[model samples]
Every structure is written in structure tokens, then in C-alpha cells.
Target chain A: MNDKKWIIAGIVVFLAIFAFPFWYNMGKAAPAPEVKLTEKAKAAKQCVMPTEYMRAEHMQLLDVWRHNVVRNAEREFVNTEGKTFNMSLSNTCMDCHANKADFCDKCHDYASVDPYCWDCHLDRSKENE
Target chain B: MNKHYLYALLAVIVLFFVAYVGAEVFGLRIIFGVLIPYLAVIVFIAGFIYKVMGWARSAVPFRIPTTCGQQKSLPWIQPNKIDCPNSTGAVVIRMILEVCCFRSLFRNTKMSLEEGDKLTYRWEIWLWVFALAFHYSFLVVILRHFRLFTEPVPFFIQLLEKVDGFFRIEVLYDTIQTGLPGVFLSGLVLLAAVTFLLLRRILLPQMRYISLAADYFPLFLIFGIAFTGILMRYFTKIDVTAAKSLAMGLVTFHPTAPKGIGGIFYAHLFFVSILLAYFPFSKLMHFAGVFLSPTRNLTTNTREKRHENPWNYPVPVHTYDEYEDEFREKMVEAGLPVDKPFEKPPETLSDEKADSSA
Candidate 1:
């Protein structure tokens, strides 16, 4: 083949780039984050909705809760099971799952999602420090 | 609807449903999520190398660059260095422009008949615009996806994400509000640009006449991928944490199929896998082929340098001396001058003696 050196070099570059993720994590172990629930959360036995629904749709639900509380001036949230709770992230959600580091940041950091929730809401964990 | 495009669309739809049913209904997440992706990556790498090697093996015996401007000739004449490159440095700059900006396509023009029955050509720039948009946005989207594959995603990727999501567009509905209100413009631009390209093929008569299933299939397949991606992100939100876990698992070679990732995610993944497997065999190989194109890669230095054909071989020829030696008698009979006079050999003398004896 003509230009054998260039062709081989191009192929090498392509393979190296495409296989970047494999080499980047070759020796490092990255197990899925296991969120630690607080004693209060364990006692409640469940979140506002089912575990599966909360796991998937919690961000959307929180957004809706924020809109309701801040814009619409409505503070009460009724879950699918007809149970009512206050529509405040700081008061209601964090009251149970208080350790933001162990609960929220674990999965968020693993997933690389920097949610702007902390922009408005106070991180009580950091407030003490 | 063209049958070619219809077949391509049908194929993509079939693939989507197969993945959806395979994952959602038949409960084959492991196969869809793990096995197929790994197999697809292997096929992609192998096929790509095979195709490029095939191209590389072909001999380019001449400098056949498609020159637009004046070539290098007289010392006094001004030569277009970028267009008709005679040096390696000029060729490299031209190649960079061609690959990065689609320089040749930028000069595209369309011809139409005017009222006077004369053909007039006009600059057509939309194809160039959308093509650039499509490629850049696709690149950004792919780079941004590194977040899913890597833990504590690389700094450049994170920076790209922030810049891509800088325009925060708040979309609110009565019941549901858009979470992570940062609207990724690249995803939307990719969809729009691909839609434009597909529409150009369907709407233009010239393009439609030349377009094949190969052209339509990738467009439909990419549209399907982008559509499902947007659906998952904005509307039918999946468990991104679980999705990331699955992506990280695949990259780390510890493949895990996390639950509650939803069928749409699988469909997106299946489309991507199909694209990867189809790349080397399809027109998408142009991504690699463009770099190896002789017309673009080679410098126009035929005048200054020699390009010998590698296949050239020695040819047996009748020299002037051999020709004169064979036709010496004939030349003498025809009153033509000869370097050496004709002389009869012993074989002819014996033949004459036999004739006399007979």
C-alpha cells in the first residue's frame, strides 16, 4: 500500500480516540453509588410516591413542587396514595433525607449532573460549617 | 413517498420496535444493553480498518488534483497556492479548510431556466449551512455524552456541557415543568439540520433522482436516535442515574443492566449500535475516506517532480537494428540504402542446390 506509514498512523489515532473511555478507566473501579438513607427516611418506609417512580421522576416532581410553592403560592403536595406533605425541599424532603452528601450528591456526582437546586435552596449540612 | 426512503424508514422503525419489545416486553435488557453494544463496537472497529486498508492499497499513479485556480507554472505568473497547491504546506492548509469548513461544498451553485430560455446559475448556500450545523452539533452531542461513559467526567467535557447549556430556556406546562432547565441547543440544532438535509433530498428533483436507500437510511436512523434522545430528556424522563450506571458499566467492561432506565433509552442505544455497525460498510465511511482522497491529499507537483507508475514493467521491443537486419534484402530490392548489405546464408545455398538437383 502507498503511504503505508500515514494510513497506519491515521488508523492508530482513530482507535486510540474511540477506545479512550476504556483506557481512562482501565485500573479504576467505579461501582454504582449506593445512596444512604437517614434514620428518619428509613422510619417513613417510603417517599412521597413509589420507589420506582421517585427514582425516575424525582427531578420533574421537585420542579413542579418548586413552581407550585414559589410562583403559585400553593404549599401542599398530595401524593399518589392521597398522603399530603408540605411542598418545601428544605422542610419536607431534606427533613428526612438530611445528609445531602450521602443521599443527593452520591448519585448526582456519579452521574455528573450538577443540578441547580442548591442555587436557591440552602444546604443545611454546609450551613453548620 | 420514494420506495427507497420508505424501505430505509421501515428498516429503522423495525429496528426500533425490535429493541423496544426485546427490552420492554421480552425482558432482554442484558442482550440489548450489553451484548449487542459490545458486538457492535467490535464489528465497527474491524470493519473500519478493513475498509480503510482497502482504500489505502489502491495505487494513485498520477497527481490528479481537481484544481480551481491557476496552477504553478511561470515564475512571473501568480499561482493560487490554496486551490492548486504545488507544495506540501499549501496542500495541508487546503485539506484543513476542506475537511473543517466543507470548502468545496461552500462553492455550490444551482442552475435554473430563466424567462429567456437561458440557464442561469445562482449561489446555493443552505446545504453548506445545514451541513456545517449538522456536523458540529453532532460532534458536540457525542462529546457531551462522555459524561455518561466516564466517572467524574473530564474537565473539557464538563466545560462543553456548561457552554452548550448556557442558554437556559424555561419551558413550563400545567402539570409538568422541564427539569434541568438548561436547554441543550446542540441536540435541537442537530435535529433541525438533519431534517433540512432529509427534506432537501425529498424536495429537490435532482437530489431525489440520485438519492438511494443508503442516503436515506442514515438520515432516518439519526433522526430516530435524536428524536428518542429528546423524548427521554424532555418528556418521558428516564432514570439518568441508572442510565449512567449502565454506560459506565459498558465502558469499564463490567457490563450491568440497571432497571427502570426505560425502553426509550434502549431504543436510543440500539439505534446508535446499528449506526456504528453500519458505518464502515455505508457512505459514512466518507469520514475516513475524505482524508485519503488522492485529489485532496496529493500536491500538484508533477512539473517539478516525477511520479512513476508502480505497475510499470519491461516490454519486449523490436529495435531499429533488428528491423533493418530482417528487411535488408527487401530494402536493397526497393532501392533503399542499408547500413549492411544482404548476404545469403548456407541454408539458402543448400536449398538452391536441392532445387537444381530436382
Candidate 2:
């Protein structure tokens, strides 16, 4: 088994080495179809500050303080969904995802794919119940 | 075997299976390739934020900075200001030097015995070279990749590219190839360094013993990410723009895993995903953990002012005088000198004779 592992590893290393030149040469001989640069790449060039108007329009220190202080700091309880239950991020995630019908169970009930984090994070979920 | 070694072995096996066997064995290419990368990024950001917040909230009342150099003292004595920075400005410079250049690590040495049984501190320059290579290459690759992740490639990104690929190796294909500031070369060097680091840990029994699976797994996983990335760049090319769009979407929270991206891309994605999900739970958490460490963040003002650990409990301490009194008879019998003379010949035991004679 170990020998087999070594053999496979060696092959991978060999292939990795040769793969580059092979692809480059192939591209040279027969050009592959061009892949468009992603919008993000385009954005990299374009996503500059829209305007400096906001920064330029300065408010008096007292006015700014009054505006900030008058309004109560809004507590963000739930996300876009108007779920009223208050909980921290990790706990909120756990609360829904821990049970069969609640979260883990719902996902598992649907045979949806779970991830490696579930192995550790779910341990707490199980213990919570 | 320790649990970590087991995890390392497991990681290797899983990597092998995914890279070679899994596709053939289970026909689950997308799972191994695409989903993993998607998952990894999500988890990485979430986990990083979670860990950082956790550190930020953790109570640290006392300031304790570990100093290795001389402190500020009398005018005649010079302080090793760089080593033990006294001011915040000095600390910031020190931190910049540390984080950017790994200045302290650059001075690393390996001690070994020579033929004459003499201890020699040989400079392990390669370790520093590789470390610097890995980090700097990582930085470059990330900067190069900015083109794919943002809407318009930032001017800085273009500038960085110009600086990086200043030497263009134009091929006959007429596509101006950027070579001088090439990320690919740096990435390869980084991979080589990471590989060397892993081997150093594994090959040396001392390191191997101390290492947990957490150590091995990240190395294996990162190695896989690099390997698969190399594959995508050189072995087979993917749609660079499409990949970037997907990345941008991810950043903007509009998740979309594009189709026709190929199985190898998915494989690369999967490896990255594994790294992300595993990061917080593994030694890689050091990225955030370093910021929270009292030894690094704290200012060394305790010497000037009393700063006690909140968790400390008051314990009765026995003084040296008490110790001497307790063991006086035994100490005298052993010919040890005593402060209180046993002779008793002089009545007022004292003041006049002691002062006058002294």
C-alpha cells in the first residue's frame, strides 16, 4: 500500500512537471478558445470611488455628534428574514442547524450535502439539545 | 500514533483519493472539485471574522509585552530601542518590519556540533529564503488575482502587474505574455518552499513528534491547492473572466458556481475549500491568534507600574528572614554564618561594639 502510494505520488509529481510545457506548447500550436476576463477583473479596473462629494461635504463636529448621538444604535437582530429571535452568529447558526427537523435534520432530511465543519460544529449542536 | 499524525495520514489518503481515485471510484468530480472551493472561501471568511471577534472580545486587563532587548534607563546607558520598542510609533515600525519582512526570523540560526566538538550556530539562510519566497509570492499571486475578483481591475492591481511582469516574454502566438512580474514563477517557488517546510517537519523526528495532524493537514491541503492551481494555469486553462466573475459574485454574496468550468477546476476548488474550513480549527488559526497574543500586543509598562493578573490569588509568602530563623540552628551546626550571634558574651549585644568595631 505504501509503495503504491509512493508510485502514485511520483506519477503526480512527474505529470505536474510535464503538464505545464505540454499545455503551453499545445496553446502555441493550436490556440485554445479565449476565455473572457471575469466581470470582477473588469471591476478591478473600474471599481474606483464613484465620487468624492460625500467626503467633500463635511458636517460640523457638533452637528455630526448630534446626528450620531440622537439616533439609538440600531441593533441588528435577524438578517433580511424578519425572524425575531435574538442570538449571536454562531449560536444562531447552531440553533437552526442542530436538529433533524430544525437544521441538520432538515438538510439531512433532504439528503443535502453537508461539509467537514459539520463534523466538529455539529458536535456542539448535538450537545446543546 | 498521535491523533494529528492520523489526521495527516487521513489527509494524504483523502488527497490521493480526490486527485486520482475519487473521480474513477465514485464519479463525484464536482463534489471533489467545485463545491469544495466554494465552501472553503465561505468558511474561511466566516471563520476568520468569528475568530478575530472572539479574540477582540476576550478580556486582557494587563499589558505584557515580551522584550528581548535593554529597556530605557539612565542617560549614560543606551537602550536597544528596536528590540524593545518603548513607544507606539516604534512598536508600529517593529510590527511592520515583523509582518512584512519577518525581520526576526531572517536572523534565524541552526546550532550544530563540529568535528572538534565545538558548538556552531550556522545560519540557515535557505529557511529564510523559502519563507520569504512563500509569503511574498502569496502576496503577488493575490494581487495578480485582483483582476478576477473585482468589477474593474483596480489601478493598483494594474500597477502591480506592470511592476511584476515588467519583462514581457512575448510568444509567437502574439498574445503578449507577462513574464517578469509573473505570479506563476513566484507561486512555484512558494510551493517549493511549502513542500520543503512540510518535509522539514516530517523528516526531522523531533519536529515530527511535536507536530500534530493539524500541522500536516494544512501543509497537505495547501500543497493540493497550489498543485491544482498550477494545473489550471499550465495544464489546462479555464475561463479567467468567468472565474473572476464567480469570485466577485462570491465576495458580493451573490454565489454562483458556473458550469463548464471543468473537473480539474473543481478539484482545485475543493482543495481550497478544505483549507478554508480547516483553517480555524487548525494551527492556521495562528493568522488571527497572533494578533491576540499578549506577548506581542501588550506594552511593557508593568516594570514602571504594578500590574497584577486578575486571576491571581493571594498566597502567604515566607520571607528570607523567616527562612533563616527557621533553619538557624541547623545552618549554624553546618558552619553557616548567622546574622544573630550565638556567643551571648556581651550584654547589650549591640550597638556600641557592632558600630564601633565595624
- Candidates' DockQ values? 0.61, 0.01
Superposed Cα deviation of residue A34, candidate 2 (Å): 11
lDDT of 2 by residue, B57-161 (tens): 566766767786887676687876766777767776676677677776788888888988999998778777777887787678666665554444446766776
In terms of TM-score, the best-performing candidate is 1
Q: After superposition, which runs of candidate 1 have C-alpha atoms over 4 Å from their true positions?
A: B179-181, B318-358
Q: Model 2 off-target regions past 4 Å?
A: A1-129, B1-39, B53-64, B169-183, B252-254, B309-358
Per prediction, fnat is: 0.63, 0.00
lDDT of each: 0.90, 0.56
After aligning candidate 2 to the native by TM-score, how far in Å is the CA of B80 from where it should be?
1.1
Candidate 2 docking band? incorrect
Provide the lDDT at B338 for model 1: 86
TM-score, candidate 1, is: 0.92
Native-vs-model 1 lDDT? 0.90
Index of the highest-DockQ prediction: 1
- Return the interface RMSD of the candidates, in order shown, one decimal each: 1.9, 22.7
